[model samples]
Target chain A: EDKVVQSPLSLVVHEGDTVTLNCSYEVTNFRSLLWYKQEKKAPTFLFMLTSSGIEKKSGRLSSILDKKELFSILNITATQTGDSAVYLCAVRGGTSYDKVIFGPGTSLSVIP
Target chain B: SAVISQKPSRDICQRGTSLTIQCQVDSQVTMMFWYRQQPGQSLTLIATANQGSEATYESGFVIDKFPISRPNLTFSTLTVSNMSPEDSSIYLCSVEPRVGDTQYFGPGTRLTVL
Candidate 1:
């Protein structure tokens, strides 16, 4: 079975603080790892990490994958109240048609 | 990325009844996935609906309980059968674009069974 585990199930931080969320996976033939942000409805795509040691960034949110360690981390710098949401990590296996295995997610709350 | 939409954004159904949720995508997609999100939980894959074949269900899920239909590359439906309180959840439909691995999601159907 493909499994993905996330650390720090929940966190509380103030604005301007930085936070790092971790995700580790155990899957056969690992293909790619992705990060998503969910506020209320649908999850918004964040980053997709396919190669190790390479950082993918979009504004204040950036993520990097460590294939050697089978883990990934999402970093939110200068966090704002709007950044408070659930961060989800998902992984896809080789030969799978985008069938992603999702982690339990980390709930973040940013206080103003 | 593709735009996805789901019908019946929410509903409160009685036990023993069933609800069918619809999903429509703006463009053709190769894979459509159904997921269930229980309260305060992560999304669980229910099945993978292909264009011309039977949907492949994941472990702990069955066709009898969650019948799915994929009539074409741009549309699909998921029906929750024999509803119980346990069936109450947020059902989301996702589509992976033909050009990328990113999976876009619909607004989701929030079903609340009493």
Candidate 2:
């Protein structure tokens, strides 16, 4: 069975603090790892990583993948109240590479 | 990325009723999917809406309870049948413009069963 796991199921931090979320997976035919931020009902795509040793960044959010270790990390710098949300990690892998397994997610609360 | 939208942004229905949610993409997409998110839970794939074919459902899901339709490449629909309190959830549709592409999700429909 394919599965994705995330550490620190919940977290709390002050504004301007930095946080790192971890995701590890075990699946066959690993195709890609993706990160999404769910603020309300819908989840917004943040990053998709297919290769290792390379970082993908967008403003204050950055992510990296380690294919060899079968894990990925998402880092948020200088967090803000607006950043409080559930950070999800998903891995696209299966016999046909059409399956997407999501982690439990990390609930982050950034307080002032 | 294509713009995706879902209909009936939300609804409150009585038990035993059924609700159908529509998903439309601004541009044609190759793949579309339906997902369910219960309160405080992660997204669970319901099915893959294949154009001109029967929707593929995941394990623990059935076609009778959660029927899907994909008449074309840019549109799809998911119907939650025989609703119950346990069926109340946020239903989302996502589109993959092409094979191996990142998926973009719709705004989602919030359903509450009474």
Best by DockQ: 2
What would the TM-scores of all predictions be? 0.96, 0.98
Best by TM-score: 2
- lDDT per residue for candidate 2 within A1-112, as digits (tens), equals 8899998999999999999999999989999999999998888999999999899999999999999999999999999999999999999988655678889999999999
- Tell me the DockQ of each model, to 2 decimals: 0.83, 0.86
**lDDT of each residue in A3-112, candidate 1, tens digit only:** 99999999999999999999999987888898999998788999999999999999999999999999999999999999999999999883455468899999999999
- List fnat per candidate, in order: 0.77, 0.80
Per-residue lDDT of model 1, residues B1-114, tens digit only: 898999989999999999999999999999899999999999999998989889999879999999999999999999999999999899999999863588889998999999
Residue-level lDDT of model 2, residues B1-114, one tens digit each, is: 999989999999999999999999999899999999999889999999999999999889999999999999989999999999999899999988988778889999999999
Deviating ranges (above 4 Å) for candidate 2: none
Question: lDDT per prediction?
Answer: 0.92, 0.94
